[model samples]
Target: MDLHYSPFDFAIQKDPYPVYKRMREEAPVYRNEEDDFYALSRHADVVAALKDSERYSSKNGLRLEPAFWGPQAEQIFSFVALDPPRHTRLRALVQSAFTNKRVQALEPRIREIGKAHLEPLLSGDTFDLMHFAGGFPTDVISELVGVPEADRAKVRDLGMAIMYREPDGGPVKDLPPSAMAAVGALVGYYTELTIDRAKVRQDDLLSGLLDAAEGEDRLTPEEVVSILILLVGAGIETTMLLLGNAWHAAAAHPDQKALALGGRIEDWVEETLRYDPPSQTIARTTVADVEVHGTVIPAESRILLMTGAANHDPAVFENPDAFVLGRDTAGSLAFGYGRHHCLGAILGRLEARIALEALTAHIADYEIDEANAVRIGSSNNRGFASLPTSFTAR
Candidate 1:
């Protein structure tokens, strides 16, 4: 049997685990000449690649799609797409805005937002979990960024517009016209929002970013807008998907679901991250030739650190395929490593934990209508856009 893989293929995206298992066993350094990239499937290799930013650089952005890869990626990905010095400086400025005190401050508000969205759907009939999964995070992020209540829906719609892809339209090698338009609209919207906040100032993350400084250096207007856009992608979208993945994974395993709903929600979140991470693959560009498992990838080549595969690698995880809670998920790369590690990770986890806690408080048990569920099509993420569920109220 031949080994063939392409992240852009929708079929592969739907169920890449089987293929990932094969890649780990047969070709640890799997190559897809057609798509022009190499992949690392083992846990150690992916971790190594993520840590070795000098050789496996993030300068070209963390995605392989044509529109998102290259010098312009920074406009969308912010510090996530940059390497040291520049990455270090921008990350520090962004970090100041997300201080421990500030994130702890958002917990009460996050719980309120989660309950507001989840309470209305507790009637015990069939409802789509994605509604709460998507809306809760959107509202949380919008509130944190100080987007007015009136404009949050518009902002969420714009953020979601860029995530859709044609599942059967072959591999999406470039962003579609709709997605490109949405990107432009988001940039324009945030740019204006920054200008507005600059004048009137507010008690929000956007305001914090504006005030964040390193000695005498501070973020410029364009830089502030860039970080806001990054939040939409990193903070809201990924967190939304992570929650949905957790809901779906729990339903798939009744035993684990019982434990999760029985006050083990934190373990549920951790295991779900290790089992079915939302952000599956992270792309990087090679600055120098690298050899792994007897294969040499030349400099200037595109490479994918198969985060999803690494999480399931038998070497790192015991009984890697099972969806069991309470496992030590300390090494999971659901969030990457090194300097480019996801800045929104702490917030993402908090949102999921609170959202699920709210959910289990109202629902006694739930079952998924998997036949009608729809997974989002994207090269870098793996999660549902719609998860129809039936539950029993507590």
Candidate 2:
């Protein structure tokens, strides 16, 4: 049998499902020689690996490459990249802001921002949803988390460059010199912002973090910076991909677009997640030796959970290839499973729903400019870098 997979295949970046399908059927747990990391493609196996944190620890770090953080910095980020008591404590410190009620309270505000940004574009015949509709949430999260409006543009640029990886979902080779400079600038800006927030103390997530850090579980000042980076970086990048991908998906399917526009956007959002998840893969490292589906993975082996493949497993979802709105696969590991599941899942869903609803409701028809709509150069995230479209406003 021949297996053709690399961590930087441009073709796979455009559409990885076919390759993932082949992987799931033929090689449920495959180790790619190119990257030297093991991948789990089947839904059941991936879910089990995610849940069994003791066996599959996160301490090895989630990124495909090492040195994203220096030795000391890596230890701090390992809070998310580790298992058990540490992940639990750190996650609990920030979990309150991501609760259903907290996310629900922001829906009206999100809708308003969606309308404000989208309505102007609706009057135009065509526009790039990635810039207009998709970019709105990045700004929204920045504002909600107390990033001053003036600094958000810089934040967005830095976040996008850092998050977008190569096609095979591998980390970028290294930040360009300019990007490195931008990182320093961003860190300085956020450092000042954190100091100011400490003084003024407003009603925002950043302020909440300051207040929450009371006793032993309290986040240090540096930890606060790390969490802000995670929040702004993860929040912006994932939502941007979701909105961008959802728009592209809807433009391709008219009936589904109509259904989405007709007050059924949640179905469309869910289907989009199942069809083309933003976070295509997540990594876990084994703590103790573990055998998954007859494959013996040594302790300390890195495991990659292919969420894109897991969502399409026929044994889990009926007609896995077909995009059926409102089809509920109760066990879809789209947001992942167990302790390290996305903290902002609800916020992401709400943002996607609002963006999709606004676009479908306001635009008569839109088509993807395939000639120019490029995929973001990231292995772990799957979405367009730019989605130019022509549309008629309703």
In terms of TM-score, which candidate is strongest? Answer: 1
lDDT of each: 0.89, 0.74
Error of 2 at 41 (Å): 0.5
Model 1, 156-215: lDDT tens digits are 899888876565577778888998999899899888888899998888999999999999
Q: In candidate 2, residue 270 scores what lDDT?
A: 88
**Candidate 2: regions farther than 4 A off:** 67-78, 165-175, 213-216
TM-score for candidate 2, residues paired by index: 0.92
Q: Name the weakest run of 10 consecutive residues (lDDT summed) in model 1.
A: 163-172
Q: Give the number of the best model, judged by lDDT.
A: 1
Quality of model 2 by C-alpha lDDT = 0.74
Residue 219 of model 2: what lDDT?
A: 68
For residue 362, give model 1's deviation from the true position in Å: 0.8
Alpha-carbon runs more than 4 Å astray in model 1: none
Report the C-alpha displacement of residue 302, candidate 1, in angstroms: 0.4
Residue-by-residue lDDT tens digits, candidate 2, 199-286: 9998778887777753655766676777776665467777888888777787677788777667778888888889888888877777
